[model samples]
Each structure stands twice: as C-alpha cells, then as structure tokens.
Target: MTGHRLRHAVRRADLPAVAETRRLLRDHLRLWGVPAMVDTAELLTSELVTNALQHTTGGAVLVATLSPGPGPRLRVEVQDSVARRPRARVVALPEDHQGTSGRGLFLVETLADAWGVTAWDSGKVVWFELSDPRK
Candidate 1:
C-alpha cells in the first residue's frame, strides 16, 4: 500500500481532543484496510494524546502515518511543548488500577510493537508503531 498520513492539532486543556484523535485514527485505519488495528491503535493513541495535553502547558500535535511495505506499519505520534520525557511506572495491576490516573505509558509499552519518545528543541514527541498483522 502507498503511504498515507493524517495530522491533527490539539489545543491545550481540550479534553475532547482525546476522543477526536481516536475517531480520526479509527476512520483512517479502517479506510487503509487495517481494521484489526482499530481497537489497540485507538486505545494507545488516546493514552499518548491524553498525556501530552495533561502534562504540557501548550497544545499538542497528533500525527498518524501509514508506511508502505509488504506489512504496512502505522506510526502515531503526539507532540507537546514540553521537553520532559514520559516514564512508564510499574503498576501493581489490580491495586494500581484503582487510582484515577497513571498507567498511560505502561499500556503503550505493553501493547505497541514499538514505541519511544524523541526530545526536540522546543518539546518532545511520544510515538508508537503497530504493524498490520494480516500482512
């Protein structure tokens, strides 16, 4: 498949942006013929976007790109105006799940095929990639 890219700018403190990003991701993955990726992709995307908006003082940017190859790979990135990197804490499972917070990066690390953070001069970009299993 040919490469396809989708980008969305998220405003600071815009909680609804989380859902918007998920919707955009779901639609694109389906259109790209990677429906199997919808659930995991949306969940992980939401985690990253929520982290960016919640932790940064400024807005964030969401970019989802589909790389062309025998097994198409989807890369989703959430860029924020903070240089600090995100860390995945060791959640105590059932107990930690009781809290109303934490566990974003933990979820990403557990689900994504590959994920990382890149620090830029102005901020950082947290991203993850999910490869099409059908391929």
Candidate 2:
C-alpha cells in the first residue's frame, strides 16, 4: 500500500470544526480505498479533537496518516497546547449520571489497535492507530 496523509488545523471550539474534521477523515479514507475505516476513524477523531478543544485554551492540529505495508495502518493524531497527557480511567458512572462525558480515552483504548500520548516542548499529541482488517 502507498502511504497517504492529511493534516487539518482546528482553530475553533465550535461544533463545526469537529464535524469538518470527521468529513475530512471520511473523504480521505474513501480516497485511500479504505472506506471500512471511516466509522471507527471518525468516532476516535471526534473524541480526540473534542478533548483537545475543550481542555486547552489554544488551537489543535489533526493529522491522519496511512502507512504502507501488507496490512496498511491508519494513524490519527491530535496535538494540543498542553503537555499534560490524558489518562484513561475506568470510572463507575453513578445511577443518576446523565451526561455522556469522560469516556473518550476509554473508547480509544478499547477500539484502537494501539494508542499513546507523546509530549513535546510546546504541547502533547494523543494518537491512535487502526489497521486495515481486510488486508
């Protein structure tokens, strides 16, 4: 498989930016001939981007890369202006808890083939990878 990449700058905390990121990932995966990855990729991308925007005061950057191999792998990364790495906690929701918050990293850890956080001098990047199952 040939490698492909897309990088998007998310500058706003508005919902539209999140939606646009999903659309961009969908289109890129389709063009890369991996439509099967759209659903999981979009879901994880939304989680990471929303987490970044909601937690940081500055903008975030989303980068999606497709690596070349017998079984191609897609890596999605969101970089924010914070060095604090996010932790995935298994919290028990109260019976009356009604909000859908605080499960982003859990979903990522559960679904992605592999995931991790890389801290840089400026900020940190939360990333996850999904391999093409059909390969």
Predict model 1's lDDT versus the native: 0.87
Against the hidden reference, what TM-scores do the models get? 0.89, 0.88
Q: After superposition, how far is residue 131 of candidate 2 from its true place, in Å?
A: 0.5
lDDT of 1 by residue, 1-135 (tens): 799999999999898878988998899999988998899999999998888888888888999999998889999998999646554434445753676677788788889999888887788899999998787
Write down the TM-score for model 2.
0.88
Tell me model 2's lDDT, rounded to 2 decimals.
0.88
Best-performing candidate as measured by lDDT: 2
In terms of TM-score, how similar is model 1 to the real structure? 0.89
Tens-place lDDT digits, model 2, residues 43-93: 999999998898877788999999988888999999998546555544555
Residue pairs whose backbone atoms clash in candidate 1: none
User: In model 1, which regions exceed 4 Å deviation?
Assistant: 87-97
Computed on alpha carbons, the lDDT of every model, listed in order, comes to 0.87, 0.88
